[model samples]
Target: MHVPEQIPDHLDFVGRGWHPLLTRLHEQLVAVSPSYSVQQVKEKYGTLRIHLYTGMLRHLNLGNTDWPDPDQAARYKDEDDAARALVHAAEQESARTCEACGNPGVPRDRAWIKTLCDDCAGHR
Candidate 1:
């Protein structure tokens, strides 16, 4: 029998969860030009330029609101609105069902309706 490897308890910036993709992204960001700091990067390029970069990054990772530029903020808002529309469309198209049990009812937690039953969601 093989034992599974354990993940560490605290992952701070990546947020708390078993997200390997986030972990991998964190590693890649650290690996590429590791010496530069966020402030340094921002200062090197003007604030607006940095904000543009931040907006691009925000699509990949949600919790990256360092110093958003006006254009970037607008772009992020648009993307968020589009995502909401897509989810609304999905709900309208699909039968009203509990994602886990497939029971026809309003989901207990709509945010996590994708990967969890009520019982499993609590435990996880």
Candidate 2:
């Protein structure tokens, strides 16, 4: 994971770490790049940027962000976009489970829908 210096304060060190979904995605995209290298990971307005984020990420075109090569930036545009889709899917999966404890869950009616395990869903 290569999180940019500019990120929401909410995303501390823990957010920079690769989530289980990302680990799996990276393994799957080895053909594209030996390993995924994110150029940015930030929350826009209803979508995530470069990582699987079930918590806080937004986009006008949700799940359509890019993850260009940190070094080349645009050399692997297609490949990065493909990897970004995988990450997006994982984020969507997170919405159906608990981000805190990873248990079966459903969306709660808030300004934004967030899925949480029974134990972690309480009062959220």
Candidate 3:
């Protein structure tokens, strides 16, 4: 594990084997690109939501449009709901099976906490 004293300005070890610095360089390149930062995205388009990015990429053919159409908005909402549901299901499943005690964990709050399943939650 050898870390360079200072990263070079334009270091290119293309043909050399695996380098950990490559990951950092890639991240820096993405950060500097117009397609990366939310601030840059907001400046170009008012909002910084993922759906907005999707709309910009998919619907308007990546044109210089800001607002999403009603159809796109609806689709985005549907996708959001589906994602939330998947997260909830995953959290609930995790709590339902306790690796430590093999007892069922209880859901703290139905609104916020994921509901545990019967086996691990201790409660029937």
Candidate 4:
């Protein structure tokens, strides 16, 4: 499938319309933690799906037996929560945005599910 050049290679599977949203999400994620990296980005059931590489959580020994200080774990948990919230927000937005033209739209189901504005949907 066609992919946008502006987006990072990891997000090439996503549509151009979601590029801005994903970019903003990335910026917000980086602000949360430089260690965070995108694992995968794709469209699933007409909505955006973003998976992040949470190496920090592992490095911090979140769920391991060699758990470190409790305070450190708490801080990492907060950061992880914030990151998850951002991803959830972006996914919710993608549901209403036209995947083809970036216009406000609703999900349509035909051969496959996709979010498209009235104009784009009509053309389809």
Best by TM-score: 4
- Decoy 2 TM-score against native: 0.49
* Regions of candidate 2 where Cα sits further than 4 Å from its true position: 1-18, 42-78, 109-113
Better of 3 and 4 by TM-score: 4
Q: Which is the leading candidate under lDDT? A: 4
Pairs clashing in candidate 2?
46-58, 46-59, 47-57, 47-58, 47-59
Clashing pairs in 3: 103-120, 104-120, 104-121, 104-122, 105-120, 105-121
lDDT of each: 0.33, 0.48, 0.32, 0.76
State the lDDT of candidate 2 residue by residue for 28-120, as single tens digits: 656554434444554332233455222112221235466434654454555557656776786566556554555666656567655556776
Off by over 4 Å in 1: 1-65, 96-124
Q: Candidate 1 — worst ten consecutive residues by lDDT sum?
A: 40-49
Ranking by TM-score: 4, 2, 3, 1
Residues 1-124 of candidate 1 have per-residue lDDT tens digits of: 3221111222232212213322343344334322212211111110011111122443344445476788977865665454334333433322233333333333343443333345535554
Comparing 1 and 3 on TM-score, the stronger one: 3
Off by more than 4 A, model 3 = 1-65, 99-124
Screening candidate 1 with a backbone cut-off below 3 angstroms (N, C-alpha, C), the clashing residue pairs are none
In angstroms, give how far residue 46 of model 1 lies from its true place. 49
